[model samples]
Target: MLLALDAMGGDRAPQEPCRGAVRACESLPDLEVALVGDGKRLEPLLAEVSSNVRSRLHVVHTEEYITMEDSPSVSMRRKRNSSLRLALDMVRGKEAAGCVSAGNTGAIVAGGVLVLGRIAGIDRPGLGVPILSLSRTSLLIDVGATVRCKPVNLVQFALMGSIYMRCLAGVPEPSVALLSNGEEDIKGDDVISEAREILKASSLNFVGYVEGKDVPVGKTDVVVCDGYTGNVLLKFGEGLGEGVFGLMKEEIRRSFLPKIGLAFMWPMLRQLHTRFDYEKQGGTPLLGVEGTVIKAHGRSKARAIDNALRVARQFVLQRGVETIREEVAKGGM
Candidate 1:
């Protein structure tokens, strides 16, 4: 399978994307990557790739590119030949199975909708991020795709999120929960209140509301919410994960005894760090887009880009889009 990658989309640019593509090719025997960016910039990085895996890497030239600060709507219209749009265009044209970008979230969503369009029954696409937990990861949908959504939109998000968790994560009957201030059914605002009724009547494993504190505990496999709230939660988790680790490091450096203790605890601490690492989570999928689209973090490096390709590959292999369409049709909402 061929995958389109925006080589110039992240903080590390062509270097990370190129190296990651090589790593992905090595890991997935059937995978090939199209690195979309300026050929001149990407050529040097490709040299660093091992000869055995080098044949799987190809570059698609494009000088035009979108910035992190560019308005998504404007950028979509203005930068037609941008690497991000071109990569997605490959998917639309069936030249690639999927596209991955570590760029601006809004720009990726805009380009995806404009280029690939949305699935027939999908009202709006949602950005679904996987949040790692003690037992398993939870899918947090609508992280930033649609800041303002209808009750029906939440229903669609729930259905799409559930399909993703089940198909990709192997959750046969994934539990779904609405993010709320309290566990009570009546806790959230009018949108959540109305959506709760619809989800309850649907065929999903509809668990009731889950508070912010309950999200990380992995009580539910899917956490559905408006984009405004979901994005805040996503950012909060990122900050908290890094902050806690930083505090631990500071304490470990305070004294010789604590430093010795750190050596004894290094293995467990490394495991915790790996669990909290955003790179390992890869990218968030923009569900409801006609083609597979992954929104990788802007700061992603080689490993993150590699994992994002893994995600795109799995999305295609598991038939995530088709599964969502089928589930939403049966959801009867």
Candidate 2:
């Protein structure tokens, strides 16, 4: 399978994505990566890769790129030749099975809709991010993709999230829940209430209501909410993960015994820390789009980008796009 990559997407630019493409090619022999960026800059990095892996690398040069500061709508309108846009175009044109970008989230979402287009039954695409909970991972949909959503939109998000968890994350009979202020069905606003009723009536494994605290407790496999709430929850979870480690470090430095204790449990601590690391997941998928589009973190390193490509490849292999279309159609609006 061929996957197009925005080599100039992240903070590290061509270097990280280029290195990632090389690593992915080395690991997956059947995969080819199209690095879209300025040829002059990417050529040297491409050369650094081993000859066998380098053979799988193809450069699709683009003089322009969308910066993190660029507005999604404006960038989509003006920067037609941007590396991100070109990478997405490859997916749209069927030159590549999928695309990966660590660029501006807005631009990536905009490009997915404008370039790759949305599924026939989808209202707007939602970003599905997997959040690590105590027992298992939960799929959080609309994590900053569409901030304001209608009841029907949340219904679609739930369906997409369920499909994603089942197909990609290997969760059978994934339970879906609406994110709310309380676990009670009577506790949410009109949108959540409407969505809850719809989901309860559908064939999905609807688990009623779930609160913010329930997320990390693994109360449900899929949590459906508007992008506004989803984004806040996701960021809060990320911050909490970092803050906990920071607190541990500060406490360890405060006392000699704590430091010594940490040394004894270093391996276990490291393993726990790895679970909270966002880079390990690499990126989140823009679900409901016609093609497989992964939006990696803006500060993604080579390892993160490599994993992002792996996500795209896995999505393609599972036929995620077609599966969503079929499922969404079956569920209806």
TM agreement with the true structure for every prediction: 0.95, 0.95
Mind giving the per-residue lDDT tens digits that candidate 1 earns over 1-333? 999999989888878878888888998889999999999998988876777678888889999999889999899989999999999999999999999999878889888889989887888899988878888888888899888789989988998888888876888889999998999876999999899999999888999899988788888999999989988877887788889988887987776788888889999988887787654469888999889999888888788899999999988988887777776667533
- Score each candidate by Cα lDDT: 0.87, 0.88
lDDT of 2 at 228: 91
TM-score of 2: 0.95
For candidate 2, lDDT tens digit of each residue in 108-138? 9888999988898888899988877688998
> Candidate 1, which ten residues in sequence have the lowest lDDT sum?
324-333
Question: What's the lDDT for residue 243 in model 2?
Answer: 97
What's the C-alpha lDDT at position 14 in model 1? 75
lDDT computed for candidate 1: 0.87
Can you list the residue pairs that collide in candidate 2?
A: none
